[model samples]
Target: MKPIPVTQKLSVAAQLQPDDFQELSRLGFKTVINNRPDGEEASQPGTDAEAAAAKAAGLDYVFIPVTSSSMTDSDVRRFAEAIVASDGPVLAHCRSGARSFYMWVLAGDVDVQGFSDDKLVAVASNIGIAPDASRAWLATHRRTGKPDVKGFYDSRTGSIQYVVSDPTTKRCAIIDPVLDYDEKSATTKTEHADEILGYVTDEGLTVEWILDTHPHADHFSAARYLKEKTGAPTAIGAHVVDVQALWKDIYNWPDFPADGSQWDRLFNEGDTFKVGTIDARVMFSPGHTLASITYVIGEAAFVHDTLFVPDSGTARADFPGGSARVLWKSIQDILALPDQTRIFTGHDYQPGGRKALWESTVAVQKHSNPHIAGQTEESFVALREARDATLPMPKLILHALQVNINGGRLPEPESNGRRYLKIPLDALEGAAW
Candidate 1:
């Protein structure tokens, strides 16, 4: 087979490939990291063929297979070491590039400060990867020195939702919260949001902003509910307009607002705001979807769904409008941050059936993530694209996108005064491609 061509370059460090080793060499990549395990018969080319091609192209190659449910911390650490020992731009690949991209994101030297879920997704997609799972994982892993902050996280939804309080002013702002939704009841609940509200009331913390990294696909956002209850402004990435536009068509909602006026604040790239003691900056990350963003606060970044616990790897970018090329770039930008910066993601599904583990140091990720370390942009892209080709669309894509694009609010009530979710028959056929 001929070498693959590079279709997207992730940040200044990564790239997406359609199996073009010559292009990788031409672009000055010296090493390749393969994240795909052998024998994923449906979507990937055989590992032996990839290794032969890499050697034939005069590049050093290493294969470190990482599965979604089986990766360990040691695996992540080893991968990071490989990147440190390598020379020149490295390319990492796996099915869909998410595994490789996440490994690199876990590798320290990346800054996720001010990146939102939608922004993370955008940046990830720019290089052809997905940030959804990674973004959620980031949130679940937040770290704080304040006892109140720590206590709050420990008590709430096994997730972190913080309101930074200034010593002088005691006022605070909330970032990325969980508003519990009862799927069986088809009704939204306020158990999680109420907890935060109680904290605000008891601690004398003034509510400022109800922030979200993106419209979460896996969980309902409590932004609207919180905003309704607290009168605080709810905000998200400005690119949510794009998400709204995309999902509006999918849901066939004629009444949905395409202009993005629904959100109190629609942040754009490089936007900044004051949230108590923290100055939140916006970074567009977007591989999981077109509207992901990251929020940078002080030395910590609420990265939402761009990365995971580092040990378990990164997010998935298989949803519609998601691309492996974009995810690679987003991860590169995150990996370029200060080494000690804490990267907090949105969710986690712990391996070993242990309690869900969240949080990973930037240093820890830089050295260990199995996917992206020691991989070049070109090679990583090729691997990601090939891998993504075999993935199936996310299970909750339709339901999630519609609600998420609306800033986590459900569709409007119909004539019967009940909201109904639409399922387009045959619309998703051959979606694995």
Candidate 2:
């Protein structure tokens, strides 16, 4: 897209992307103002993507959104303030440059010096923006907010645990935390949980919820342990019952309950909750497992095992109840979110021995994530199946599933106080050497 200059201090573009920031920086743009709110239009870029790009390009980025239906004075003021603070030219963008151009013209403090409203209207007209209609919209939009997120890596399972918090009140939710386990000694430890606990304490964060993306096959869940430590209620996808039922048969436990009674709360799709004042919701994203669900909290989504890092491709779907076919649908759903949404994944294999990385945007995944970037459902399934066929099962799958399916609780002792694990031999397929 071409940039239209309004003055020496500013330029307007219809919308900006992470890749666009570099050229804008080269063009001497010191600041970028996002006049688009997150999820305003499904699949449109969000502030996070633009901000990350701007940061990498050494440009200051600010989010000052204005909906087409309602543009408030506060929105204009915020835009004006960001423009005024820039040391070089500024670039402001939205779905169409109309919202941005309208904000610049309406933002009384902006330096549109010799151009009056009439001239601004003419300039907008040439750019195909209906200024009058946008003016009508300007007559009512407010700005939007963001979330606070942090990730912790467990070296053992290559899992990434996250703490998503409400900055205003410091209330937070922990997502997909790992339980430290040693298969050689059959020992369980709390180092992973302790790190999260320590961070929460140091940050003065109130643990509002303990979440498990699914019953992990790679590592034991720290949900129950974290809840015990923090007294926070635990939650998992409602379909965990299905997982329990499936695994119960495999383990040959006749009397085990298949109902999901272990978790404090069971989340179905579209279920909403709060961590402090920030709103969060659930999306059923299965395929890595039957119970895998994503926790979307205010522009950030914890998409566990759906899509891996761009370099690493996606998660395997050859496990029980797993389907690369279904995973394609799930990934499509996630990519349908605003492009700027911050996606914190569950694991990172540190491909090529690189450092662990979990943070990426929906935009990045849509274009670069090797697995889903351009492949169709049929192609993805073919490729995923081919790859999964060559990879061995996770080291702890046998040990972890029993504990994870039982709400991360060790089994009851038989007469003796010592707990024992039920490792079913010849029960699971692909029992790799």
Candidate 3:
């Protein structure tokens, strides 16, 4: 078997045959740890036969059966013991090699020289291991730093705009600002964006960046308007190019460039930037929209459209290019943040007509959010799909996308000096009647 090395002394592989044991020994593995239980599949060998082969090959063998359903602290302890007791290089095997790798991670104390815990967990997830255990480990070890946060509620759209600032430097970024729109009048105004500007001016805060979580469906982004007013750069997730391509087809804009040039910076997953002196990074949190992202600035996560207040539940994932399963995974990642990390959501429907509220913590969401808290992946998908199936398309979806995809700029004035919005008939199919 070809082994994928995890550390200097350890490597992992899929199920091994009796003939494979001699080749493993020849390759200088001093011990073999079997993480798969017997009879898992009809074609696989039993533990006794595998142990006999190892003995014949002059290599020590340790049996540590692990399954996704039955793994426990005791299993981790046994795996740790086997790892510590081994004299030299170890080759571990499981059905698909994920369980063996997972056990090694949970055992802890292994010096994966170049990997931080977050990076290590991401690596495990990429290799097909569920990240819950490691996510908990990450949350427990997260750094503690509170960045000052201010949320402005827009009663009209049920959206909340934010200004996350470094208290020491008084430097901040405006997130998901809205450009006021009156649907009946077919006009847009700067009232919402100006209010944010007023807050910045009064607080002596300098705007460093103007960011959008995604191309919004319900409201026009004020990224371009705010950039003109504050002179700060505008940014969005890099996958916006994908959204641009999709929408350009529906709008029939043959010459439109869909290369993500609309924004100043296109952020990729794990991309890091600074909000003043505070450390900030990007998490690609798509599902509500193809290009959605969450900005984890200091100890606060600007999780636009992924989650809402614990009382309000989560965002809807029925828009074009959205998926319930993908949204579930995105929410899990946000919940994986430190328990104390402040979660600022994009919209708050003010469910039950309660007063507008927009902030919650990771711990609160894990315990109180009905959309999460006890729901498995399968169950969550069922709930979300059923709920979304009944909901009508957002009233402003068509009106908002054209402007948002162009970085919040309204289309240029026509020959008569009047700007216009183009509405396509019969474009959105399967919308609620």
TM-score: which candidate is best? 2
lDDT of 2 at 70: 67
Using lDDT as the measure, the top candidate is 3
The sequence of per-residue lDDT tens digits that candidate 2 reaches over residues 387-419 is 988888888888999889878787888887889
Error of 2 at 30 (Å): 18
| lDDT tens readout by residue for model 3, 161-230 | 9988876688999999999999999988999899999999998999999999999988999999999988
What TM-score does candidate 3 reach? 0.67
Q: What value does the lDDT take at residue 287 in candidate 1?
A: 87
For residues 1-433, what per-residue lDDT tens digits would candidate 1 score against the true structure? Answer: 2212221222122223436666778777777778778777655666677777788888777777887665555666556656555666667777666666566544432322333345545656655554666556444432222111321343323455666554335566677766665555666667777888897887787877888887766666677778888888988888888877877777777888887787788999889887565566888898877888887765566677677776666677766667667887887887776665567777666666655544555655566666566767677677766766786765555555666667667667999999976766566657773
- In candidate 2, position 140 carries an lDDT of 29
TM-score of 2: 0.70
User: In order, what lDDT does every prediction score?
Assistant: 0.64, 0.81, 0.85
What lDDT is obtained when candidate 1 is compared to the true structure? 0.64
Cα shift from native, residue 235, model 1 (Å): 1.2
